[model samples]
Target: MKTKFFSLLVACLIVTSVFSQANLNDYKYVIVPTKYDFLKESNQYQLNALTQFLFNKYGFETLMEGDEYPEDLVRNRCLALRSNVTKDAGLFKTKLLITLKGCNDQVVFTSQLGESREKEYNKAYTEAIRNAFKSFEAVNYKYEPKAKDVMVATENTEVKNEVAKEIKKLKEEIQALKEEKKAEVIEVEETVVEVVKKAPVVKVQTKEVKNTKEKVDMKASTSVLYAQEIENGFQLVDSSPKVIYKIKKTSMKDVFLVISKNGTLSKKGSDWILEYYENDVLKQEVLNIKF
Candidate 1:
């Protein structure tokens, strides 16, 4: 009877473990911090990089903190788990443990304690982190977004399609207007030519040149902007600490609607580009933004 009960308990435990691992598949991304709490600076000894690599190797899509997130993840942060590493006090050895938390700050999973006896900080941390990742290897994480996430994605897709259709319709109307205006201008020019041909021609010559320079407005573009997080977005300030532009968050990732400038700020490659209309002319400026 005792043997049978023990076997049943073991089976229940195995089932529970499997269930927990399967739940992890609901998360689409693992966000690793650039710096661990135990370390002095960011990515010290390349430990964070190794952590990211290991997560990727175990079939988990990993991203470093502060990296531009996918639009879905930005809209619904709960789809991604935040990773943290903690170091335990050890006299003769280095020990590390990895913890993953949800967007609500709930602990989702914790790795087994990883230990190394190496004296060097780099080697010790690397070995300890790798050892701790054995748990992840066993689980073999693969992203399988939940039903709710899939529904949300579908809704977003529908909205984007509607918006695209409206934009296309507007473009077609503008093109038709331009064609009509071009035809009207040609007719007017032809009338002017007929009048000139019917009238006598007279030419006037002058040696003196008249000044035709027009006043132009110059904007300073050398000031570096500092981003300060606000309620829905951020306010950019210059070195003098004066607010330059207030940008609001958009549904798209790495794209913000500039409230102050009536423009859009978007990330293109490694640069942040600001585009707005000034004096009926569209202008694009590369912003030196420190976030």
Candidate 2:
């Protein structure tokens, strides 16, 4: 009886150790979101599917995923996470965080999920994450992301001046509208002109037409404001490589920022060369931003 109990205790210890030392990698390239994001958010199934497909191709299994209980509220997910974590919380956790492991505890990849803002992040977010991860082609497992150089600015005084003037105009228009709203008196006029009856009616008709046109213009102005505030529609470039390179800072003379497929910003320093591959094969390194 004693021997049997001792053996069982040893077995239990081994199992516990295995669970505790679980590798947190998902794959080589994509640092992925944990499964909880998929379970909690009913929508974004397409995002979930793409994530699974990428990791499954590389033999990644979903480890035990649950509420992460971050050290602080993890800034980004304070609302969902319920804490004061970070001001740029969206930078990290509003997105799902998936992990993949390989070869006895080596980290493969971790990917983030969700778009940055309230806007419904489209399939592009996932695609961006996937492509960012896919850029890593080393089979032996080196996951250093690189950044491209910031383009040199050319001298164009005229263009710069025009842009400055246009921006100023837009700002002034926005302010003028706001001021007009605060101080203007909206008067509804009614007057009976005793002179030449037809002439007075014509004047009244002309004023009514002008008011109608003004109403249409006001409605259009409100729509323009809504578009500017809500849909910003800023375009971004891929910067995972740039971000990684900056972090490494190996012989880097300048800095670059990159967006991983997971929609997070990364930094890269100088010594980075561009790499291209089609299915785990390197095509070439061009060494120039445009190339």
Q: Against the unseen true structure, what C-alpha lDDT does each candidate score?
A: 0.83, 0.34
Candidate 1 at residue 200, lDDT? Answer: 22
Task: Name the runs in model 1 displaced over 4 angstroms.
Answer: 1-13, 198-291
lDDT of 1: 0.83
The alpha-carbon RMSD values of the candidates against the true structure, listed in the order shown, are 23.0, 36.9
Residue-wise C-alpha lDDT for candidate 2, range 134-243, written one tens digit per residue: 52222223222112111211224456788999999999999999888765422111111112122322344345447643221111111111111112121222333222
- All candidates' TM-scores? 0.64, 0.21
Give the lDDT of residue 228 in candidate 2: 15
